[model samples]
Target: MCACPAQKLCTCSASSLKKTSNHRKQKRLFRKAFFFLQRLTRGNQTDTFRGLLLKSTCSFMKNSIFSLILLFSAALTGFAQDTIVLNNGDVLSGEILEQTASHVYFKSAAFGSISINPRDIAEIRFTQDQLGEITVPKDAIAKNEAKPPNLPASKKPEKAAAKPPQKDTSKKTKKKKQWSGQAGLAIALRNKTTSNLSGVYKDEKYETYRLYGNLNWKGERNSLRWDWTYRYSEDEYKIRDDFFNITQKYNRSFKNKNLYATAKTLYQRDYNRRIENEYLQTAELGIKWFGKDSRVKLSTSAGGGYHIYDRLDSSRSNKTSVSLPKFIFDENFSWKILSAQELEIIQKYTHLGNLDDYHLVFSFGVQNKLVRELFLRVEYKIDKDTEVFYDDKGYYDKALLTSLVYKF
Candidate 1:
């Protein structure tokens, strides 16, 4: 098994021998590269090159190889791509989607569609693939500039021939309608205990929940919308109150004018107020200030409507139906305080045939964006009625509520 001399033995296995062979091959390749570089420099710099190559470690070779690979990749990327060189020495290589005097639309793999201002760009370069030709060297271009190439008669540039007018091929498109709406819920819960001088103990649990929503559709000249609110509350003993109201409105703006016409209808039911059913229909001529998309908006209208309702007797034993003509005044204001926040206030007053029989309702609300199509809403509302059939003191209610809202 021993092929070497007396005390010396070969410790090489098959793997070790393969590794040794690889090391020798690498040394030969390194020597060839060193000699090539030495010949290429071939001057006083030859000694510097030789010293650096011979004294460098394997890691240095690896880093140099990696840098060369990166440079080659960059060169290949620049060959068939469009480029934009920014004034701050930033470079982008991608396909140019469009170019205009003011802006350039470019698409890149790293970034999606991008809009770049022309002023921010220092230069632009496009590929010659579109023309199916390659560029020549600077020396050849300079020679051509010095002496124009001779051309035959047909090859010379000629004045463009006048062409007939082209027919219009584009079709007219209708304006698209925009739709938006929101839905929300507000709820409250409470627990209470009461004791009398007679030691009569009473405990009650109260809870209230309200659900509301609105839907709106807007077109070029016409818009339609509807709103609904439902509230129900109860104590341990029995249901305290149940209320519901819904209104639908249709509006049309006059062409080339700020005036608009509105038609609205409302239906309501309230168990606490002894309102069996109520219906109102109103037509109004209104005026709107500012554009529809403006940050601030104000609108007001005055109208007359027919109101019909049935009310229960004071004993809650009999129902009486009555219809009357009423007057109405409505005003609305909205402000966009921030890109993601909005505030709105609305006031409405109704007057029956008797001056003493009237009601006023005021509502204020704010919506803050939480995420896409979702919001946090805070609302304050007041309802005051000067006349009542079952109670001596007029009805008055106020509430401060918060809810989570979703828009679509």
Candidate 2:
């Protein structure tokens, strides 16, 4: 500040003054360059060096912007690519060209264009834009097409315009009334020989014959059943045991099909048991624990009814008639051990209120098929009664029977 160069200038050393002068010159050069560029662009003459540089710069910028736009468009299209997933865990990115009831046409960058069965594709993913106008057929997306080798000619797919409405033919076949029956016969012979003064004389000769039959008519919700059995035996040409029984039953099933109501009537005669003639009428409710087609079946019934019995008193040499209120319980069980063999067990209990007596009958049998409709049956039965009479030898009676049966 000893001697200022000017009013607003400050005195400095020689090196500082040289640096300030260099800075001033740089500023002047910058200002001159900026002005020269501005004047060159504002002029109308484009053939000069400045005009050519400006044109080149503008072209470069335009090319860079177009390149960016192209890259963005490519990225968007790649993100929107469709996908096809196959059943065998194959994934393919593609565009769907067309779809029909049985096949799909697709185009892919890697695999080119190809036609494939819709059955082979497990899933498909489409772009949002493609989904709006997709034309895939409903059946094509729903059901798998049958394979070519085993496919029927009638099932071949036609053109989309010729497609027909699908028809459902899956209704079950209606059942009709069915009838089944069985018949059987049995014969037995016995002989007694005594070795006395007369050598090997036939003392007793007797024969037994038995006939049995069963019939059933089955409908949708009801069934009718009939059973008949007859037995005759002679000892020394004199009738020894004569018995017959006939039963008729009508069964009506409930909505559950396993529960039912039954009306039954029975007529019977047994000379050995001293029952001359008996009649029973009853109404019962029954339940089946298993289906009819099951290998094992069990059914139980309980009812009360009136029974009229004509009894023969051998000691008194007279016949008596009695009417009683009876309570009855029945259980029937059958098991099919094989296709051709079956086992059956039947049990019945009867309680007589008037006589204050109870009766039980049980039968066990095995049936084996011998031919198409013929079977061999072996059965053992036991009958027991609480009532004792003069001719009632024991409290229980037992019998064994073998018969040949025919079924229809």
Candidate 3:
């Protein structure tokens, strides 16, 4: 069969069309030959016409059969995205180098690993996990329960095959490969009539709240985290404030795993009545412990830094209390009630010499599929002293919010 270069284009990819085109061209040739045979028999005797038609039919069928074999061969060659299964129930998508009764050799496109035994494997499969330019199919998780080859059906007996060598399962038991990541984005709004931060509270119920997002990138061993939070309220003036933070984190679940810690820095910009600019710098070292239970997880960070408060320039009291950074402790926890919902709590303690106060952050949220590619989040947050606002009197703030999020 003659091949066409441009025929490679398809509704999905260019590869499949080339194979289909070759099959279709053979079909067209078969149809043409059959029609020609019928035309030749139009002016012939009964015997001659029957023989001619029979001969043409056989020839076309032969060509069709050959075409099918070619099509199947082309479909299987040089285009296989095989999945490799591990003993600990882990799977990797890649190309297969060898498939035998005992083991399978594979080479990963993203992460590299070597020979794998199918005995400890649950299954193996091939799929279209790879799609567009640098994008893989989200639903490309395929599984095959194909069992090992059985003994021949022949009555004659043959020599048994030798088994392959085993690897160090002890070391494998000590370490496990993990797939971990977290990412989220949110926006919120609030309104207060007319409120005062300090010195006799008034009615200022106009405020807007927005939390940009946090992106977590997981590497082979470590992870990088970037996150920010922002809230803005408008009374007679345009007031906007934001809090930004970045962290480089490490996590491990195995006993022999390395230390899990994080180094983070945060900045805040607030425009309120009493204090305008509040800035803080912190460096913390902490450890995290989690399991597949997902019911409970805890993380604690303790360190020291400097926080500036309004230059301590209060003219009201000559005995003003300055906001000096002494020590800080942060505690965070997450409880997964269900597969789609979670309960989280955050607490931060600020020890500023004499004026020490703690702010509590707690929320109850459920991650549910609102619609196609859409998610709904409803959370209620209350602070014992929500007065984190500029010049907020020693009081906490409370609010409830709902959000609709879109994802790609």
Candidate 4:
């Protein structure tokens, strides 16, 4: 009678409610299983599920053990066993590729490769299994050994053998001084036979002779040079031209070696030009634009000095003596075409207080070495002076000479 009242209040049975709860539980379990399978097979759709899983497992295991593998390798190989201790209390670890007298080459993982001066290194330590064995000093071994019984006074250790004195091999070598000289002579003779106006045969003889000498002494920083030339000519048994010149020069070089100070003196006499005698003294400063070591050398100088001109007829005529201040400019050029051949050019200008009264001289030459310290030279020279006497004759004089030179 009590169940009749409860059934009238409830519409579903207990068994149906239990079945519906079971269905919901099954659906939740299926969903969880599907999601778990999807997660395992993601990102590996082209491969079989078993292969993908195997690969992933292997990758994880390899990553987890990589550092352990590296550690074992380093321990076995001694990666940084080549150690260098520096004098400044620093230590460097690297693989030493080579050691030289002055430097060490090392390779480091961090720095790639580098050079180290031996002076900066205090010690080098190598692994026990390296190519070479480290040497231990006797003193170090003695310190590590046990003490021995004291020796008698007569058995004391002998003094170490004394080392022989070493030679001083660092001094600079000195260069030798150079000396050169040249001498030349030339002669010309002409004979003319003709009939005179009186129907008489006459003979005319002309003669010319020239002599030249030059000496040069070159040292490390100084040079001395001298040159002399003499010429005598007779035309038809009458003296036509007679002249001589002597010149001396001393040069002192400065610290630069390319710059120098020079003192020069000259004495000259000319009968054809009416210059009985002439004297000149000058101090000059010069620069060598191209040095002696080069294939070509050029030099220039400028100076001022006093000049004296004495004429042969000044004493007999009303002409006064010529004394004037003089200015001079000089240029010298030399070129070595080969080890045994050379070319030279020299030019000089002397101004006697006026532009119109000046003298110019130019010389050019070629020299070929024939033997050791001996050479052959051929030269051409021109001399022009505004103050010289010039009439129907030319205003300038020209000369060509071939000479042999010797050097010491």
- Per-residue CA lDDT of model 3 for 314-381, tens digit only, reads 23233223356646666666665554433333233333222345444445555555566566666665
Across 303-331, the per-residue lDDT of candidate 4 in tens digits comes to 88788877643223444478888888778
The candidate that wins on lDDT is 2
How well is each residue in 103-165 modelled by candidate 1, as lDDT tens digits? 457777787567666556767777743433323323222111222222221122232367998
Q: How are the candidates ranked when ordered by lDDT, highest leading? A: 2, 1, 4, 3
lDDT of 2 by residue, 342-384 (tens): 4443333444333457777777878788878888877766666
lDDT of each: 0.70, 0.72, 0.52, 0.68
Top candidate on TM-score is 2
lDDT of 1 at 375: 78
TM-score, structure 2 vs. true:
0.52
TM per candidate: 0.51, 0.52, 0.43, 0.51
Clashing residue pairs in candidate 1 are none
Superposition TM-score, candidate 1 onto the true structure:
0.51
